[model samples]
Target: MSNLNFTSGQTIPNSVIAPVSADGKVCFYVYGKTHLLADVSGYFPK
Candidate 1:
C-alpha cells in the first residue's frame, strides 16, 4: 500500500498475505507512521 495518511486517534484495519523467503520473513513499508499486527492461523507446506 502507498500514499497512506491517518489522523490522530484514528483506527484502521489492514490485512496482507505475502509469501516469504526460505527464512519465512517479509517486509512492509509505509510512508508515515502506522501500527501493524500479524496473526498466523496456519501455514502451507513448503
Candidate 2:
C-alpha cells in the first residue's frame, strides 16, 4: 500500500475517476488512518 504524503493545511489537486459504479459511489484507497473531504461539483442525470 502507498500513502499520500501531505502536509497540514495543504491542498491537493484533482483526481481521476475510473471504473465508475451505477450507484455513484466512490472509494478511496489509503494506506493508513487519515482525514478526507470530498466535494461534488455537479451531477449527471440517470
Counting only residues 3 or more apart in sequence or on different chains, how many pairs clash (N, Cα, C under 3 Å) in candidate 1? 0
Worst 10 residues of 1 by lDDT: 1-10
| Per-candidate TM-score against the hidden true structure | 0.51, 0.42
| Candidate 2 residue runs with Cα over 4 Å from true position | 1-19
Q: State candidate 2's TM-score.
A: 0.42
Cα lDDT of model 2 by residue, 1-46, tens digit: 2335676677776554344477866676755556676666666565
lDDT (Cα) of model 2: 0.60
Could you report the Cα RMSD, in angstroms, for every candidate shown? 3.1, 4.1
- Highest-TM-score candidate: 1
lDDT, candidate 2, residue 45? 62
For model 1, residues 1-46, the per-residue Cα lDDT tens digits are: 4534568788876555578887879776755566766687666786
